[model samples]
Target: MLRLIMLATAGLLLGGCLQEEPAFPNVDLHGRLVVDQEVTGARQAQGIQGEYYKRVLSVNGQDMAFNDFVRHYCPDSNTRNETCIKAFRIKKIDDVSGATRFLPNGL
Candidate 1:
């Protein structure tokens, strides 16, 4: 008798798990359009690689695509690679010697 009860309980549990869930009303009836985007050459260079993100910014009460004030270069202290490095690392040139305080390459 106990074995029969266990089998019945297990059957009920498995049966409940197998049922499909009902979708919400009007979900598919209303939403229909789908858009797929593919990244291009310039966007590929800027988006996953470029240091900063492009966004709609307010400049002088006008909206424009302006590059942020940033410098991208590989620091000498780190292993040089294709990855663009973002740093506040300032390049100061000696007024007298006319030589940079450090190696600064910004692109």
Candidate 2:
């Protein structure tokens, strides 16, 4: 019985680790979409090399990471599609620095 309990506990812990992160709600988010370039030396050393582009949502000056946006608005789909774009109510696109910024409607 003790062995079974230990096995069950371990299984639960592993299951939790394998689960996907919680997604944000699909509410109207007012923000600017910006591209954040992420480079990891560790990943490159492991033979995975490339510039990873993360879509950051800057709302009221606060930045939300790509995972949250993709999980909420475009799960299992590309983040640059019309659905994701329309959700933010894009106003203007500007090339600032190395990031592509999309201004939200209104401001």
Candidate 3:
């Protein structure tokens, strides 16, 4: 009799666990479409290496297109690369002169 009671209790516990209920709510009855712009080019770079990166920048919760900010700051297209680097908060020049910064072959 005691063994039968134990078996019955275990069966009840296992059965309860096996039953599945919806844990999360499905509020969206209508199908929703999500859209996002694809990211291209280098995400981060410093100085001249960052030239022609063509990447969007985000700063202090504000998003600015790469070329837009670069043109606004530098104005001169020739210095766009340098301006873009500075705008994105990437260090343009190494504080210590004569010291090599980036590795060879864009490593």
Note the residue pairs that clash in candidate 3: none
Each prediction's Cα lDDT score? Answer: 0.32, 0.49, 0.37
lDDT score for residue 43 of model 1: 50
What would you estimate as the lDDT of candidate 2? 0.49
Clashing pairs for predicted structure model 2, backbone only? none
Per-candidate alpha-carbon RMSD to the true structure: 21.3, 12.3, 20.4
Q: Model 1, 1-107: lDDT tens per residue?
A: 99999999999999988834222121111111121123234555665542222222243454432122112122233433322122222212222222122434551
lDDT string, candidate 3, 28-84, tens digits: 111122211222123223222322222344533456543444455545434434333
Model 2, position 2: C-alpha lDDT score: 100
TM-scores of the candidates in the order shown: 0.21, 0.30, 0.24
**Per-candidate count of clashing residue pairs (backbone under 3 Å):** 0, 0, 0
Q: Candidate 1, residue 105: CA error in Å?
A: 58
Worst 10 residues of 1 by lDDT: 27-36
